[model samples]
Target: MDLQLTNKTAFITGSTSGIGFAIAKALLTEGAVVIINGRSQKNIDSAVKQLQAFVPNGKVSGIAVDFKDPSAMDAVKQKIDQLDILINNVGIYASKSFDKTTTNEWHEMFEVNLMSSVKLSKYFLPKMKANNWGRIIFISSECAQLVPEDLIAYSATKAAIQALSRGLAQTTKGSNVSVNTLAPGSTLTESAQEYIKNQAIIEHRSEEDVADDFFKKVRTSSLLQRFTQPKEIADMAVFLASPLSSATNGAVIKVDGGSIPGIV
Candidate 1:
């Protein structure tokens, strides 16, 4: 089915790999012009090349500016003058005890995860409202509701981002612009695989055993009993970024494999 997204432009932050890259691929496949972001030129080039190889004739470009830098958005604005979709996907996470997490880490989490969305939304939401059409998706996590002990700061920032998305959606009342949050469960990204490998080696367990332990013990609420693939989450994001999802605004849709228990 056509998503009716031909020629529409989208900018996805932190799109060098994992879920972000997956979203870029999905959007490009749907015939959207996609601009990807990463911290370094090498990463941006690599991701763009991979995306082009995956979707020949797809219009794709890249921006290499570390989101941690205060002037990063300025550089981004210079490259992208406008957009039909703005996905705030750049995020940083630190898994450690709350007490062990440094104050600097907390600040960094808020800066990259929450503040980046704030700034981007501030810039694009107005343009969207003026044009009378746009899509803004915040890539939240199930941890926002689960609030795992080791991911206190990350969880807090995710929850705050959802709130921010809802508030921004409210501003788009009576318009075609929509802002929503997509909450995902733990997915097997390259970094996550490395972490799993390290844990398996440290505990003298097989890789499969380590992943099983994660769902069985740590993520007991996960009904799927496995990792949610990056593409799985990307599918939802691509829809939300399209004109088809016009009715879904100010909502928190979960692609969390039932890890977030609720009826709402």
Candidate 2:
């Protein structure tokens, strides 16, 4: 299980928390130099401390760049020239009906979710190609296939991610560099934790009851019948980012709880 990641350097966007944080920790654990990203210096500092403590003697650092502000990425470009793994994990979501979702919300969704990946890949992929070895991973979502009613915009961006990742992979042809996507189902990130807590209070039930109701009603197709832990999704990402996963280019691998139903 030596992922062969020693000395490899990885940059994971929005890594101050949730699945991104888990991925950073996983790579650090495997002896990778991990660069974490977040919005503010304070948050980035805190995450770095937590990660350092959690991953024994881990080489980790952070840069503050709010991906929501597209211009902020310019700062990121100046910090690093080459990367062994570039994971586009930064994203935002707004749950609203088509009529209720404002135009700006739609734009923001696309900008943050899809454009961030687009921008990062544009800068890093070519460098990776020149180096003749790298990994570009987009963290998409199962909603791309499920297309939940309230999450239309979010799902649209995720669907675009699949297409983008495939197209990018096509450019890698015979190179050791690879581009791929990993679609996670319902995961227990901070937002999800808040949702469960709020629902429990609103329904006068336990948090467990709220989670059970979510699986039974909202995400009825979930075979796992529970939220997947952030670490579980991170594990798949870690594997995909490693030199061991060279053969999985252009693939849209799902870590869903069987929520996305399709034979392929």
Candidate 3:
């Protein structure tokens, strides 16, 4: 389908690689102008080039912002005045035990995972409402529901994201603007691939075996029994960001491959 996204401007955070990058590419493929964000200019530039190569006529650019410093978003504000889509995809996490996790780590997780979306939505939601058309997508995770012992702080932030997205949608009532959260399961992004490779070598096992064991042991609830590809999550995000998803506001849509059990 066309998605009717031509010329729509989109901004995706933490898009240098992984799910965010996949979302960026998907939007660009649909003929949207995409501004991707990363921490360093070098990575941003490289990602922009790769995206352009993938979608030869794509209008793609980048902004370098470290969400750790809240003020860093001001740089982005100066460059763009409005947006048709704002995807809050930047996040950071550390898989450490609760007691072993430092106070600063918890703060960092909240800053990047939750506060960044809060700040960006605060800035752009009003503009979207004024224009009477927009889409705001928050990239949450199944971890919010399946809260693993080592990921308590991270899961807390993700849970907060669902609330944030829903509340923002309430403000867009009777308007074309929509705000929704997408909770993905364990996705096979670049870093995930690297982790599998390292574990395979360390355990003297095949990469496939290491990956399968992850689903069998660590993520025993996953019905798919494997890691989901980044594109799988990105496809749904592209739909949610488009005009076709006008009826989906305030909903926490799961693209979790049944990792999160239960019929919603």
Q: Each prediction's Cα lDDT score? A: 0.94, 0.94, 0.95
Q: Ten-residue segment with the worst summed lDDT in candidate 2?
A: 65-74
Model 3 C-alpha lDDT per residue in residues 55-92, reported as the tens digit of each score: 99999999999999979779989988999999999989
Model 3, which residues run further than 4 Å from truth?
Answer: none
Candidate 2 residue-pair clash tally = 0
Q: Which stretches in model 2 have alpha-carbon errors above 4 Å?
A: none
Q: Give candidate 2's TM-score.
A: 0.99
Q: What would the per-residue lDDT of candidate 1 be over residues 1-264, giving only the tens digit for each residue?
A: 889999999999999998999999999999999999999999999999999999999999999988888778899788887899999999999989999999999999999999888888888889989999999999999999999999999999999999999999899999999999999999999889999999999999999999999998999999899999999999999999999998999999999999999896
Which of 2 and 3 is the better model by lDDT?
A: 3
**What is the lDDT for 187 in model 2?**
97
lDDT of 1: 0.94
